[model samples]
Target: MFFKLQSLALIFLGFNAYASPLAEPNEVHISERGAGLNSFLNLLLSYLPAIDTSVTDATGIITDFDNLLGALTGAQETYNELGRSCTEWTVIFARGTAEPGNVGVLVGPPLFDALDDKFGSSAITIQGVNDYSASVQGYLAGGDSNGSAEMARQIRAAKSQCPHTKLIASGYSQGCQIVHKAIAQLDSATASWISSVLLFGDPLKGQALNSVPSSRVFTACHALDDICKNGILIGPSHLTYAVDVVNAVNFAAAH
Candidate 1:
């Protein structure tokens, strides 16, 4: 009986010694990144009104926003098994409207009515793809043309927090265009760290990405995605953004 009690005590001590918290320093770093990414959703909630007002016309925007939150937030769980993770950092490229007034889309439909009347039922075509980028530049850099430069600085900040970590930019429609410009302006050192870019229903002028590295660029187009292809004429039409990311992740894991 004395020997058995001693053995049980040893086992308990061993378990306590091995027990560690689920989150490590790297995990905390990645969590911060995820928080930054979620800030974009907050930006959307704050700025959706004064910029386009067209957001009110599309019900899909809300749905897509929810889906994006799920995908990004869930990325940690999905990547846990692989030991590869992300530190998501998302921010508003621009700011148009003030908060308080922009809050509550369902608070009686006054704002919704304004948006529907302005944008109408037809899908709004993205003509000036650079407009939002320009706005973002103004917001971040206090000027236009310097938006990409600002983005490079932001990437550097992220790198400082998480050294040699992979960066992925995923955007839909017009958002993709803004991300593309940000990628273009990135310095070579920063560019090398990019893992993949996932573009959904890209509508921006294809020429914006001309100088960007071809190997890293991928476009995901829906069959009926007339929205992105409307006015754009030429550019890389092959390879999809979503499939490329999945394949790239798998390849990296396997290797």
Candidate 2:
């Protein structure tokens, strides 16, 4: 009886340890790295409207914001159609900081091409998020809740609506921060359903290093990428991830 009781106690202790939140990884300190003049400028830019309201149409009147709303709605409809057809795997991609409406240029074309080459076009589905400011301000000031919540919702929907399909979540730069936040909030079962997570030039790399098992998470940061440097000056390397996408896809395939 004592032996059986000891075994049960050990199992309970093990489960509790596994379920606890992990200690933060040792990395460059955000406070020391993320502060300074450049960081300030980046935050300021996030507050300014990306579009100029002063631009007028041929009728000499400013275009209504409703036009932008309509375009976004149309895009969502198109994405919904694609999502409905996804059979094998779904890749939810989040764009980098301050690059709204540019995920196609930044990571989509090459990443999707690689996936199609490996699994065929119809075997994969692509969903991209670019509406958020994804700026330094959003990351530092906790304004990423909306973006993280949207990401979490999509993940949950994919799991419930497509039970057999695999899920791969990829993000770049500040987008990586959002993905990390979303993943951290997921229930263990839903988190386990994610086959892989790929991050490129991740600014929040330190904070997220232990969120998942190292085997399921892959990260690539350029040696010169200042954004991933945890508060260093922004550099040209931050703008490129073509090679990383290919590598990430390869990792996903193998896993």
Candidate 3:
């Protein structure tokens, strides 16, 4: 169901509960990855000030919310496109990550460490340059010029590696901002090449995307997770994005 901003305040506080102990990363990459996405989305949904009951269906609720956000930002077309893409790509990536089932979490530091360990074995190629520091704040914090540029470079390179394949850029928390900035930087022609962007914990101001089309960006945030509650800047505002099936099921059960 669609939630009103006002009603969100009541259930929003519940998100802080999950912020407690860090859940052990799943040995299986698909599960761990999906957990990471849920963790972040829980945080997003909790921040909502209201819930719209008119959206009785799960997918409809998300679409209605996206439409609401799109109306506010005057980007309905983009938001609609992105909403569809996120749903489609979730299955594609989840399946791909499941095969190895050892890809590791997508969070910073710990996740990156695990990824490094995986890469050492040469299981996955070093698709992007390691030039940008994977710091929690500095460049990796997202939105920094260097970090965003580095991400663009990675996408361009990855695109070249598999020219025929669709490219999906998935990120968590601050990483989401970096991905968004990179996508924003792309020219209309180049941006179209992206198959999808799955943002696990998008915290950037969706309003900031006024210049770009929303259809290319797909954001997923936790309803009771608080990792991305506070932005690097300031203010008590929380970020919100569309949720995926794995997360939708989790939230439904929680409610």
Candidate 4:
């Protein structure tokens, strides 16, 4: 029992290892995780290859084990709501540093599920910021230039193509830095399309979101979340932001 808890603790605690800040991120690091835990994560993800997010069932809530794992592992990584008959809202998300997949496993999936459950799948589109690597060096350097540019391009494309969807830009950890940089790249016209901005464990917490109004933005920095103060701790507090999803979602929906 202790082993299980310790294993999870290690996974979160291993994040923000300053010693190897420049190494490329791989599943938070393929070698850093034990073989047993790796196998367990793989098996857990295999049962539900597609998160089926953005299309909630009659129950309208994610309750299954595999389904919940889907949210944790970023199974909704493929959810892109563009090119559909209608898109009332569009969410462009950047995952944390070292997290696997474009959306990352930690925060992206749960956010997708919450938006889906609240707004209904048909009303929203969630797109992962695939253009960025979410690299460690990028986090240490404030933000990756290329990643920031790519995210801005995506935000512009989403709003330009749909022309009607309310845009939401979101990020976690290093992803938050990219969000900050990306927003800076936007012109006044493109910036106005952003209906809401969500930042979790933001490294640039106090810094304003260039053109986005404070009333339309929601930032969550849990107690002891060193990242909020520009520290890269990635502590247990950082992992607990999932608990704030309901409030964050409500905040987003309001805008």
Candidate 5:
């Protein structure tokens, strides 16, 4: 009995050492990071008129939504262009924080390629966030709030339009916060359609983990990546996710 207790105590200590304060959902305060610049900018932006964000289509392309009529027209045009009716594709919406096109160029291609390779066809479309701003302000406020809302709207719209579509939500850094917020707001019916959630270097990893089921969620954080280890401290470590993308693809393929 004493030996058993000793073993258990050692296991507990090991677990604690491996865990970060970020492992606690409520322990890490996102608002407390970085002198409140993000929060202040968010407040300033609140006073301005709202802008149309973006929407995704069956082909996993994200288009700008200029207005109500424009968005509708754009969606229809995209659907038609992609030959929407004949082929079934799994949609993967990927968002990256602070970088203009890093998500598409860096993290998106590998995952998309993997999915295509595994499925033996171009079975996946990656819709990257176009309006993503790489600013400290945007990071704190969860990227663009309007953009995030629009993403949620598009997810619902796509699901309604294509009931057979499979959805995957993915993000990196502050983009993970956007994905988490958007997913949380999804209705049960829409959320149920989500097959997987992939997050890399997520700032709110612990809180985001609780928003979705463990079986459908996968995350990767580099050991030396301060952004994942801490929050939003930029370095070369946080910039790469080649291995993580491979793991994500494997996870998605299995599911």
Candidate 6:
């Protein structure tokens, strides 16, 4: 949430730098600014191990690799398409605190794009909660009441409108608090409509997600993520959830 100007700029610029050769015009852009050089270095390092071990021919790198990076790139945009029509999946994602747009840039859009690549664009519908302010004050209150209600409203509608769709609830940072609040507001039967839950940098990290079973939920909290820990210490670790996209995607996709 507190991304320094230089760090945020460098994170995306580095991606653009390396990806530019393989990417088309505006093809290698990042949506929202993210945590600075650490995020860039982490992503770079992830590929390094793979490159050293398996990628003998760099030219042989395939579209899947590009697709993965592309998924994490986008413009700050708000979408409210979930439950618009019955589809294979309905994904409702909330952006982190103070993040712009409904879905936010850091994690929501990337997750949407990644899922789209996996199951085709038409196979799923993704929506972000634009009605919520995503304010820090709201997070301190254990999530804004209005935001929680709005998210709950979407959950109710998604299930009623598309009974068979696999409804997934996901959020990052304070967004995770909203998910917990919204689900708690619902009755057991209604809450059970959610197929899976994915949370990153959760403030309520170790706590149960009310009616949602632990088996169906996955919370990605880095050891250094202060938000996920006991005390309040907002470090760069809290903002680097972009690193967990692959694992988050796999968990949501499987369930």
Give TM-scores for every candidate, taking all chains together and pairing residue i with residue i. Answer: 0.38, 0.64, 0.42, 0.71, 0.61, 0.71
Candidate 1 regions exceeding 4 Å error are: 1-56, 59-151, 205-212, 230-255
> RMSD for each model, in Å, please?
20.6, 21.3, 16.9, 12.7, 19.6, 11.8
Expressed as tens digits, the lDDT of each residue in 7-86 for candidate 1 is 54554454343222321122111112123333433332322211112322333333332223223222111111111232
lDDT, candidate 4, at 109: 69
For all candidates in order, the CA lDDT equals 0.34, 0.57, 0.38, 0.66, 0.50, 0.67
Model 1 steric clash total: 4
Query: In model 5, what lDDT does residue 70 have?
Result: 21
Q: List clashing residue pairs in candidate 2.
A: 33-231
lDDT, residue 207, candidate 6? 85
Q: How far is candidate 5 from the true structure (C-alpha RMSD, Å)?
A: 19.6
Instruction: Point out the higher-scoring one by lDDT: 2 or 6.
Output: 6
Ranking by TM-score: 6, 4, 2, 5, 3, 1
Q: After aligning candidate 5 to the native by TM-score, how far in Å is the CA of 252 from where it should be?
A: 1.0
lDDT of 5 by residue, 1-255 (tens): 123556545544543332222222222122321222233222222221122122111011111111111221111111111224422555445445433343433345445545555564455544555445534566666566765675677667667666676667777666677677777778877876777788887776666442467789888776655566535454334444533565676787666
Provide the lDDT at 5 for model 4.
Answer: 55
Q: lDDT rank, highest first?
A: 6, 4, 2, 5, 3, 1
For model 2, the local distance difference test gives 0.57
lDDT of 6 by residue, 1-255 (tens): 244667556655554433322111221224432344234434533432122111112222212233233334324457889647799988888877766668776577656656765677799888887689877677778777888889999999888899899988989878898998889888898887789999988888878876888989989887765678633555445545665666677787787
By TM-score, the best candidate is 6
lDDT, candidate 3, 104-215, per-residue tens: 1222222222333333312222232133333434423344556567667656655555455445555555455566677677766556776555555566535344233465
Q: Indicate the residue-level lDDT of 202 in model 2.
A: 83
TM value for model 2 = 0.64
